[model samples]
Target: MKRKLCVAPSFNCDDDMEELNVAALSSRKESVAPLTAERDGTLFRHSLSYPLALVLRLRVLQIVCGISTLVMGSVAFIEERQKFNMGLGIPAGGFSILAAAVSIHTSRGWSLVTGGASVGAGAAGVLWIASGCLLIALIVQSCRTILDPSGLDNGDGEAIEDYRPSPRDLIVIACVQIVLAASTLFSAVVCARIDCTA
Candidate 1:
């Protein structure tokens, strides 16, 4: 009598072994997990550079302009003898301080709205000859920055680079400054005439 060993087919054995291997692989993949946290951290670090630099520059510009306005407005208020001049100067100083604070708080970035308004108010508050001169200087410097043609980027062939003011904006600012200067001068003349009449 010949005894034969009962065994499953070789194909079934191979199939079972393949299924076990696949299950093991799936479990291993689940355990190994992806490095999403590390990848996201690196991505955030890389992306923050440009925006941070821009914010820093904007804050610096805002602070400088704001301080200038405050100082000029205060000087005018102190130096002017007339109540009207004092009134103008006080508001100018207050607006300057407010603009600076808003610029620092808001992340929308600096623009002519805040800086221009401060400068315009400060210019309007010009009561003394020294403040007038300073106002003129500030206007010229701001116009230069606004009109700088080289501010456009040539490297990447982009239409514009950084934040350069438009020609229209410069023209509007110039007009406002001119009007403020004229008004200030007129006020000075009127005051002088009143003194003469008195």
Candidate 2:
């Protein structure tokens, strides 16, 4: 009788290894998906065109602030005029509105002129810094008024959403002002650092 020899086929080992490799690759991809998504989200939030985005945001907020300030100033003026009283409140508020308007116009004009290049970036950055400082002042002022409920007397100098001024409006405005001020500050920093040459 001839001796029987049993030889294991090499294909079985290859198939097992291929299966394991495929499974490992799949597992790796699945495991990395959430992390990849999280990283992408973070980059998307932080990697925005800092200066441009800041400018745009500031433009919109400035418009809103200008309009609000104008309204408030007008109301204050009418009330004061009716009472035969003259004060700096109206003028100061009006000046704030004017400053915001000028900032908006300056930014728009500069963007149009320089196309966000190095030509006027320095001047623009300075202007942005100034505007941001002004915004910070406004934010501080708003905070003082919002934090102290008693700070608003007759709600004359305060903003209101309804017939009677409510603290809710002030709180909301304060929150928005804080956000705007922070964004302005961040924008100023970014503008200051921008190379503008590339």
Model 2, 116-169: lDDT tens digits are 533444554454555555555666765674675334355577633333344465
lDDT at residue 31 of model 2 (Cα atoms): 99
Candidate 2, TM-score vs. the true structure?
A: 0.37
Q: Model 1, 16-64: lDDT tens per residue?
A: 9999999999988776666543455323233332243444454454345
Local lDDT at 107 for model 1: 29
**TM-score for all models, in order of appearance:** 0.29, 0.37
Backbone clashes per model, in order? 0, 0
Best by TM-score: 2
Kindly report which residue stretches of model 1 are placed more than 4 angstroms away from their true locations once superposed. 1-46, 86-89, 108-198
